[model samples]
Target: MTLRVMVAYATKYGSTAEIAELVAATLRDEGIEAAAAPASRVADVRPYDAVILGSALYMGRWRRDARHFARRHRRALRERAVWVFSSGPLDPSASERDIEPVPSARRAMCRIHAREHVTFGGRLEAGAKGRMAKMILEEDRGGDFRDFDAITKWATATAGEIIALRAEL
Candidate 1:
């Protein structure tokens, strides 16, 4: 049977949602069944063999929806292969090096027994909905720093790992 994966994410201005969609698409391309959804809308994790949970970071904290999802489904998530990601670095530092998870993400990962956590570059654009975002744009710091190539690479590797686990099972 094909393994089913959920790419659930929380985003303030939709960049992280797009990343989640790409992840699901990449997994599907790798022959796995995957779908992306908002973390808040996912009422259950029982239907998925694995889950990749992601959130947009602001001020080094995860979105409230993502935090609630992790807490609300912690038990179910522990029973599945769980991975976590954060997107927030407006700079290329995420692509240049491995960035550590924020304290909240670290806590959630430990609580849910997540298999891995990754940090990815973030995007900020004009018309984004936040005072900080507006200020960033005004200061010319707003741009799409997300590296799709890196995202695809990570998703491909995640698919390989999931497939290998299935084989062993």
Candidate 2:
């Protein structure tokens, strides 16, 4: 059976959406059927064999839609392979430092016993505007500090875990 995976994310200015696509690509490379889309586009979870949810963290919290989706599907998620991640916390040395993944984002991880929960410092363009983006822009140690290599590695590892788990069934 093809392992169907849903890679869903909530993004404000498209960065988190890119992250979700990376995870989906990793999953697909592992011989699983994976797809990526916005959280708002995912109508239901019952059709997928597994789910990987991620969101952009704004001001120490995940996007609202990602939170709600997890809450709505907590029961179904508990029975399948689930993973979580958050993007958006630009630290200059994130490549070496262990950035704290938000607890709110990790809530679904606990509920589903997810294979992994990852946090990647996201990028903010030079002109990050809007009230929230502007606030995040105010923080120092900031720049486009996204570690693409590390992100791919995390996605691959998570995919490997899911693939191995699928083997048991």
Candidate 3:
């Protein structure tokens, strides 16, 4: 059977959404059928053979929509292969090291019995909404810190794992 994957994400300013799009695209390139969508809009997970859920991190926590999505789909998630990611940290830290998921994300992973969780660098360009975003820009601390290479690499590896798991099944 063809393995269908859903790459669902919650984003406040679209960065996480872009990451999700890239992940889905990479998975497709790796021969897995994948679709990217907003977590809030995904009311059903039964159609997907696996799920990769991501969220934008703010103030060291995941966006509310992402947490709610996990809560709403916890049972379905547990029955399928699940992975999670967080996009935040407006620095090269994520590219330099493996950052642990924030407390809430960790809990969600445990709740859903996710196979893995990853943290990716975030982007905060001009016109990004929020006072803190503006403040960071004012401080010259804002830039597109997302590492596309790393994102692609991770997605590729994830696709391989998903394929292997399906073969085992």
Candidate 4:
């Protein structure tokens, strides 16, 4: 059976969306059938064997749709396998430490039990940012800073895990 994977994401200014697209492509390249869609439109999780949900964090919070997506699908996701990633710290100068998980996200994680959760430094486009976003951009130390290589490698590893699980089934 072809593994159905979803790269569901909530993006503010499209950077995270690009990341989600990259992830979906990476999974497809590994022979997993993957789809990319905004989390808000993901009404059903039953069609997918595995899910990779990503969110863009701004002002230390995920977009509302991301939270709602997890809450709505927590039960269904726990029955299968899921993974979560946060794209933020748009400022690479910021410490590359694991963020203190939020209450809602933590509660949902405890219940849904996603296989893995990771945070990666994000990208910033100076032209598109607003006041606060611009402030955040100003603080960036430099470079593309999106870490595409790491993101692609992690995505491949995620697909590998899903492939192994499918084999066992």
Tell me the whole-model lDDT of each prediction, alpha carbons only: 0.95, 0.82, 0.95, 0.81
Candidate 3 segments exceeding 4 Å error: none
**Residue by residue across 39-130, what tens digits does model 3's lDDT show?**
99998999999999999999889999889989999999999999999999999999999999999999889888999999999999989878
- Over the stretch 103-146, how does candidate 4's per-residue lDDT look in tens digits? 55555567678878777777667675578867755776323457
Q: What TM-score, computed on C-alpha atoms, does each candidate reach?
A: 0.98, 0.89, 0.98, 0.88
Per-residue accuracy of model 1 over 37-129 as CA lDDT, tens digit each: 999999899999999999999988999899999999999999999999999999999999999999999988998999999999999988887
C-alpha-based local distance difference test score of model 3? 0.95
Q: Could you give the C-alpha RMSD of every candidate to the true structure, in order shown?
A: 0.7, 2.0, 0.7, 2.4
lDDT of 2 by residue, 46-117 (tens): 889889899998888889989888887888888887888888877755577776668777775676677677
**Candidate 1 similarity to native, TM-score:** 0.98
> Which residue pairs show backbone clashes in model 1?
none
Steric collisions counted per model: 0, 0, 0, 0
What number of backbone clashes does candidate 3 have, counting pairs of residues 3 or more apart or in separate chains? 0
* Candidate 2: residue 89 Cα off by (Å): 1.4
